[model samples]
Target chain A: MPQPDVVDDESVAAVEAGLDALDTPTERRRRFTWRRAAAVVAPPVLAIVLLIAVWQALWAAAFWPEYQLPAPAAVWQVITDNVQTGVAFDVLWNSVHRAVLGFAAGVLIGTPLGLIVAKVRIVRAAIGPLLSGLQSLPSVAWVPAAVLWFGVTPSTVYFVVLMGSVPSIANGLVAGIDQIPPILPRVGTVLGASRLGSARHILLPAALPGYLAGLKQGWAFSWRSLMAAEIIAVSPQLGKGLGAFLEEGRNLSDMPTVIAAIFLILLVGIGIELLVFRPLERSVLRARGLSGAF
Target chain B: MTATLETSAMTTAVRLTGVHKSFGAGRGAVSALEGVDLSVAPGEFVCLLGASGCGKTTLLNLVAGLDRPTAGDIALSTSRPAVMFQEAALMPWLTASRNVELALRFAGVRRTQRRERAGELLELVRLGGLGDKRPHELSGGMRQRVALARALASAVQGSQDGSPALLLMDEPFSALDAITRDVLQGELLRVWRSTNTAVLFVTHDVREAVRLGQRVVLLSSRPGRVVREWQVGDLEPSAEAAAIEEINTSLREVISSHAAA
Candidate 1:
């Protein structure tokens, strides 16, 4: 397309946008800008500092004794103590392994379920409301039933995690499929695409962002459910995961240790989101030009 | 070569007979097309001219196999046609090349051949060197051109017997600005001439119909049926002015009579 001598503002914007897109290299080469980096890193750091300051102030005031509300330093000391003994790392690893394994299972089970619900009208009509209803019911509700079925073993925790995440993954896929523009199917039909061919090429790719969002939510649910099962269900066979560690601290009325375990759980959840989901989302949005900038 | 061209011209690319389309049923049913009959010979350009609710789009949809007629037959000599809507329906996620390649992939073009063919088609539309850009990155006119490229790719890749393509465009350039529309129309004419594609171009614009179509078919509103038609060949500037004047008179009469009814 050539530039016309006389152009409107809208056309000018379109041309500029097109030129920007064309100029983009095959590999994205973003310059390291300190200001932009600071814009991302500042808010969370500031919030943590503020939260600690508030915790210290209340501790200093001796509000309801140190046992009930430990000082920030007390929790910090517990983290350092356990980390020095390498118990913290081991505990963290045990919990993450369960969540990741269960999340993988959720992906395997839920994806096909989502597709089936999306495409098969009869299946969707039968299972649709139940799937959503299951999502709303916290995975903790399934612990007792899972224990009765699988007993106080690692399988109980796995079962609970699967229950927690599958609905979200399936429902996410369904929503993604629903968002596909009707034109894509017509395009496929005209171009002589078989139903399966179009499903592979057009439907799946178009529904990806929504599915990614679902996967993120599914992972969160998996972690939460695993933690819940670990807290409630006692297993001599199972190692002390974060949930069990927190439970042990409560049993002993060890507030600082409990708070440290809570922090570790939060840290892992945040780490996975930052390391995995954020990058996935940013790249997707950037490719589609849905992001504010490349 | 002349014999083959002559034979192709004599062959009917599309034929719609006694096509009746009515939405809903009984008392509330709205009739769109009643007793509509039309045909396009291979290599012919026919513009369906009508007001809103005149079943021009409905008729096009019927021909494209997107929808079926309530009563009647629509026969096509060629494979399924390539349709371009009023809105350029380019997939936003794919780059310009990939969008065209998607049609090629569906047309059963091998992975090895798709890229070169896509590049060739893009070059044909004068959209060379911009294949990697996404749909939103392109201007409205450019997007429509990519859509045209996709439609062309579909036609070529389909049938595989080297059949002359059939293109059904529903007000494809109506959304564009005046200058951009003129530029695209010229490109369209060039492309059409090169491919010898049979086209059924629908538009509400009378001047546009007279300007583009080899023959303009006037369809009446409210139960659309062919009211009149005019053959317009070699629209030199002088002839274009006279054709426009005649089309305007007939168009106004159609609108006025519909309003009275």
Candidate 2:
């Protein structure tokens, strides 16, 4: 027969009472409402509106001559005409398609390469600093090498994109793995987890925020590299990518088209960040009690 | 539970003999433990007591198989021990139930069974309704209880050919307020009595050692050796006060001499 100790039930009951009264310190997620949405969107909207007003005022004042700073009306006319003719849509589709393909390829190559490098000391020791060094080299600098290797082909554009992005993705995973607390894996080990199991269950999940950060950076790199390659290695074989379009406008001295392309690039970059990366980072940060500050 | 009780008559849960640990090699080597021997038998509640740097935790780590002893024999009849660190060490991404379920998952429990078992473990810790909450959402004491639940899950799991379970707790309630600590101490005793798992608890508090341990082993500082041992398992609550005072007086003497040195 098993003998049980007569526990201090009153004390247990007391703590039980205290448990309910213990103030929950974790902040409840701020509710999303129309008002909150407006509060968030209002400032940015005002800033953009103010920017357009200033641009119109500059055009009215005829600052920097018509050739250098085209009238706001002329820029608007270009955007409206492109929207109607669907030339802007085709340019966007072509550039975005290339960027998407290159970015996917970068993720596939970089994620595994990062995992291997982060876990294996020999690999990390050999190429850790080399990888970070690669990040500092402008992706545009790869245009010449890519053109030499693949000529004026889509393969050349992708080659530059891969060189630009792979390092960042690998670097991010390494950073994420490094930042995981040593105790978590130690705890995992004592719980009878194998080395690989510990890394999977504890290290990887803990390092998710950092990996996501890396992915976001890698996308930016991919876009930049694609544009650089497009500008340098422009060919009808590569299609009318945004970079080639911008280059063409420059060649033709059509200032409005160049400005329009610039806007499109900024919008795409901002859209990915807002639509994809921001939600990912927000959920992770909020779970870790880091959302408020970070 | 019956299996653990059956092992009580013969096998020891963990045995450490002449254990020595040094952090660095040669001239800079700082010894943590030297010529230490300790053992906890099946279903035993043993507490190792010492001040900071007394190598209590180092010894526990060695026993838990987290580190290797420099020159000693350490044995555990149990397959692998479960550890509850001072910090909760809960996965922030997981809910309380999922955190417990992770141990079950590692143990190769059926996917369909994990959720129910995890819920039962959470309820065992008196955290029944709070299973869905995140670690950050809970109070410090609640988090530690969930951590304790996780440790328990590990203990009962992965027992192949019926190896006994050993639980290593490193000052698990030291961060809590005095009242919460007291309540948890009671809860621990109650749980220990029910579960029949061997516990090797490490703490510096003499009262806590006396309160929780069937056998309290006091270690001396400076490369930590076994200084004294007490079998205080059968004391009454009234007698515990005097016993605590006696232990405190001896600890004070040891501290004074060290301070004078």
Candidate 3:
């Protein structure tokens, strides 16, 4: 027999270290810096400034009459007036509180509903198409039926928000569950995980990106549905929300207040997406090495 | 079942008796393996060789308890066998040591001991300092090493009465480049020797089977059945040129017969 070369721990370690050096990629750690922040923040701020400037020019040119297409300053003045009187906080609080409560309820209902739809074939066959159909049908259309059922109470607003949000949340979870690679569950099984154990350890974490996406979409739907309810389901007992304020402006022919309400609605929508969901999604994606772009 | 019981005195890591597996039922049924009878003794290294569609992976899956056979029986000494796939199959979201810990956890290791044991397992695979790195951060070879550590942890967990663990590997090195594969095969041998685990390694590479296995078993292609076996004796299979040539010649005959059929 040919004498085999002596195998030692030292030589193996040396060989492994050499191979690793050749193969290990030098990773560039991207630090969060002021310059990166400015790069992201600058464009949107500049766009908003340009929009105001164009509005001012249009008002100066008297393109449509002052009452119909009011100056940007007039809309700002209306917002400032509401803030001074503390009406902005009150109306903002009422709408936001309703949205938060409705979203929480939707999550409770939608989670079990999603789990059932994803796992049970018979249940999925029966209601899967219905959930998808409900998602496409505008939640605003439910406001009229909600008002008729609940008679402009807080329940009516919550009912409309739930209708808008549930389908989106459930469908998002179902889609996430569907996207998990088949190898993952098989790996779990071979590792000796039980069915429940696999779901807890493997399936849920793997499905997070999809579930988070569903939650973000569900929030958006709830907000839109709440606004529709506030505007259409009018009663003296109902607190004045941004949507209600906009409706009052239309009744009194106050264009500045109408524009102000529209701006507040846009601001709140973008704020929640930026402050809550975006950071959460970015972290989850980054942890999994799925984040390629900022 | 009787065949396994008959061999109980020597004790085995795993034994398959008259194992048959089929994919579907009725008119469209496809058989993958037929009448497969194989066994791996504790701490023995056996390589299962065959052409593509020879049901090597199907046999491993049956041994791993991932699937039931259409007929016959498979019995194992341990509660479960550790399995390694062509891909590392580590969870992307977990760190390397954490991935190893997951297997330990499933094997019912206490939380207090899991971290320390996981570290030891990583050291055993020569992945000592890279434990905190995620799967994506490691090279393909490093990821496979972590997977090896995880498999070792699983084996330790399933072992009973100081018995050696059983490991099922399905072409675990096929995806690697030549140099990495050589390094890993050497590493695997070292690990296998020190740990004293029984390994049922499946591959289509004849040279690899000869290089690693104490005994090499050959299966005919399509609805695979054991066609032949060769004992490499005490000398290294690589050094035994006559034995290597004999096994290769038999393998060629099996492939040609497949073509003819």
Candidate 4:
């Protein structure tokens, strides 16, 4: 058929404009008010308060000896002293630096490993099961072996951290690649995207959620392995970390110091999650219109 | 007539001769398309009408170069033929404009020009000012329009002789509501007419085929072959209705005959 006349074009555009006006959803931007902030923030704050209250009550009730399960104030005092002396910063810096370096290395290595395994049939057949197995194995289990190989040095901690994270990161990528709808790659092929172009533009982006989830898990593993390595491989060269601090508290039989160290560990874990992964996940999911509460 | 024929041959968008495609080998082998011969002229609007299991999609894949034909020759004037799937297939991570831009990027458009070109394509699809919206943000019909824009972006500057490229659409509007489908059909017609791109639209909807196609080819089921063809050029409304009814009757006969056999 010939092209529509000018009048037809005008009317068609009018009709389309009308259809679009009706069909397009109105965006009601939910303003983040103080009330909304409180709604989100109050629960966690209240939970911590409630826990502290319970701990105080337990202390008052004398459920355990003061030396065995130190008072909240004693633990608080220990934390304050560490902060005041700048020891807390040193401990956190040591642990965080190792965790970041190890995780970064894990990402660099795991990404290509995952890509190779995901794309190459022979590599997948050879190592797919092994990757899954490694993800399940506790990184702490590698601590003794890592110590034996690298000695009681920073390398031992890093070796343990890598072992903990690499499998999770690589496996996460593989899972992400696997979950991609078959039609997506076909669409890429039809669009005439070269293999590398498709990987960059299509495959990696499609697998982002899975890969992010893997990174989060990998971080958790890295932290855990670092702690395990530090606790076991106690050396003067490896400056005191949170795990070493906790071990020191144990050796000194100081309940307050031990509790303070444990609290710092928990605080760091939650802080990293909130500061890094949660926002990353939220943005990624929101962009994809999958931001509904899970 | 001889001169016109020569021109047609030179300007052919795609041609498939004795094209055969099968799924597997040995006892498990299932043929999808067998000895299929077809040709699409430049700037033609052709619809392939067939029931489920007729290998309409397989034929499109073969032509799009996503898959090779098991046997026989499939030739295209352009190496990169744009394709739109049933689903919009817009990258979830990309906004509507970015999705279109990605296509332009692949089509070898310079980075500096991609954003502007993507915007123009979006405007061509009547999706102007909604380029920043992601696929999930847009309504189903709107997403399909974005997909249409992306397809158009991929087609731009595709033909070496500066002619329009081919677009293979596989039931792109089948997933939409009737009202949305109607709107999109009109939009598609407008786009096709303006761009002068050859489109081989595959669908089972006879009404849609008659509504949009300059020519409609019917395919037989289970190892699909072209069973019939209809040229719907320059028909009046009443005559178009009559043509639709005739095609529907023939389609029913084809389906029933297959059942009986």
| TM-score winner, 2 or 4 | 4
Candidate 2 positional error at A290, Å: 2.2
lDDT (Cα, tens digit) per residue for candidate 4, span A133-165: 999998889888877888888888888999999
Positional deviation of residue B3's Cα in model 1 after best superposition, in angstroms: 29
Ranking by TM-score: 4, 3, 2, 1
Superposed on all Cα atoms, model 1 deviates from the true structure by an RMSD in Å of: 5.2
In Å, residue A53's CA in model 1 sits off its true spot by: 1.0
lDDT of 3 by residue, A1-294 (tens): 232232576777788888888887667898999999999899999999998999899899998988899989889999999999999999899889899999999999998898889989999999999999999999889887887888889999999999989999999999999999888888899899988888888988888899999999999999999999999987877788878988999999999999999999999999999999999999999888888855
TM-score for chain B of each model, two decimals: 0.93, 0.93, 0.94, 0.94
Cα lDDT tens digits for candidate 4, B63-162: 8877788898877776578999999988999999999999877767798799998889999998889988988778888999999998887875576556
TM-score of chain A of each: 0.89, 0.92, 0.94, 0.95
Q: After superposition, which runs of candidate 1 have C-alpha atoms over 4 Å from their true positions?
A: A1-31, B1-10
lDDT of 2 at A134: 95
TM-score, candidate 4, is 0.95
Question: Cα RMSDs of all predictions?
Answer: 5.2, 3.9, 2.4, 3.5
Q: What value of lDDT does candidate 1 attain over all alpha carbons?
A: 0.85
Compute each candidate's TM-score over C-alphas.
0.91, 0.94, 0.95, 0.95
CAPRI tier of model 3: medium
Scored by CA lDDT, what does every candidate get?
0.85, 0.84, 0.88, 0.88
Instruction: State the lDDT of candidate 1 residue by residue for A1-294, as single tens digits.
Output: 222333444444455345445533454457889999998889989998998999888889887787899988889999999999999998999999999999999999999999999999999999999999999999999999999998899999999999999999999999999998898778788777898998898888888989998999999999999989999996678888999999999999999999999999999999999999999989887777677643
In model 2, what are the clashing residue pairs, if there are any?
A: none
The CA lDDT at A180 in model 1 is 88
